[model samples]
Target: MTDQVNANSYLDTDSSNICEVLQILGAKWAFLVLNELLRGPQRFNQLQRNAAVIKTQSLTDTLRHLEQNGLVLREVFPTVPVTVEYSLTEKGSDFQTALKEMNKWVEKWGKPQQVNGKTSISS
Candidate 1:
């Protein structure tokens, strides 16, 4: 762990005090939603389409959670159908560094696990 992360008083990184925020981010589709936003801003339907496995309701719930945590910004434009865009905030953008590290770790150490006859990656 880096000194910066270790010095962050906001997060109790100790094993017994795992942050609740981590649980929120680890929620279904949350990481994927954040990952997609890292590429650029996207509309609701675009996120749904790009994230094929996520249902509409799941995406809605995850977006709400991310927004609540100040990781995402939702902008609504006054269009005919009311276009809504979601983009990462500065905090969220900073989080991408950690995600990139996690991706590297997964690629190196993760193994495939079977779930209902399908292969899924697990560490």
Candidate 2:
């Protein structure tokens, strides 16, 4: 399959349109990381801890991908060992509102699916 890359993202350009926005949001781990950042900005380790089952490589890749896509911002602090934190950009924060609405909708009428013997999205 041909990798879509910017074909689906980047709405401000002539190459794409708003209709393709889902291609950006639907990226793997995109929404998950966005949801975590919705709580607040976090260091890489903190993000890893909060995301739980996500592997280090996966988190790193996702963060890099999000940053590249202009959805997440990465700030590097000047310190002894240096610290890096990730937070959502304005576009990303806007996307969080959508995810929150989806969560609310899911809670209201989403089907009950078995996940590890408990309901999916169960805490």
Candidate 3:
């Protein structure tokens, strides 16, 4: 085999790390949740309200998944009734650059169209 490595070698399907990251990010609300967390730490209720469309169970599941993946940090504070907040870990914050690039790409090429009353991109 040639010594030169393909630039996209890490994107191969067999790359477990890449696959895992994709799986985590491919979840329905992952992007939105990450976008929200990029701002700052937030409580469960705040995230739920900001996300607008996610159900309680779905948000919980998403947060748990993010936490399990080392992308989100969950902190519990001692208070009258106890308080919990979620924020991005270093690894998660590192993903911001990728998200910014993705935003750039969308702005460059995404064509918004009406699809069943929902806004979708046209190829």
Candidate 4:
């Protein structure tokens, strides 16, 4: 008799780690907000302006989640009305290396093509 392979056999630790990371960054606004912060610290208004397409509420929620995950830091100044600024934590800054690698991978193997009004990546 021939041996059969299990379809689920490919699941492994690396896949689990990737899945967990995606869960944290997969939100519509999370990566966008993080990318903006990678430039440096900025006030809420500045982030909203630079991110352009993100709504005020969505930006607020994304910042809150990033802060909770220790990927961002929120600071408040003792100003008249209270000023706030957001910056990436060390953990967040470390992600820049990974981003660079992903960008390189895209350059090498991620040619985009239009298909029925949608875009798709093809090697």
Superposed by TM-score, candidate 3 places the C-alpha of residue 40 at a distance from the truth, in angstroms, of 0.5
lDDT of 4 at 16: 87
Which TM-score value belongs to model 4? 0.80
TM-scores for all candidates: the values are 0.75, 0.72, 0.79, 0.80
lDDT of 2 by residue, 1-123 (tens): 234656544534644554467667656787889999999999999999999978999889888888888899999999989999899999888887777788898887788889888877432
Where model 1 places Cα greater than 4 Å from the true spot, the runs are: 1-13, 112-123
Best candidate, lDDT: 3
Candidate 2 error regions (>4 Å): 1-19, 113-123
Candidate 1 lDDT over 48-72, as tens digits, reads 8999899999999999999998899
- At residue 117, what lDDT does model 1 achieve? 98
How many clashing pairs in candidate 2? 0
* lDDT (Cα atoms) of all candidates against the true structure: 0.87, 0.83, 0.89, 0.87
Question: Which of the two, 2 or 3, has more TM-score?
Answer: 3
lDDT of 3 by residue, 39-79 (tens): 99999999999999999999999999999988999999999
Q: Comparing candidate 1 with candidate 3, which one achieves the higher TM-score?
A: 3
User: Where does the lowest 10-residue lDDT sum fall in candidate 1?
Assistant: 9-18
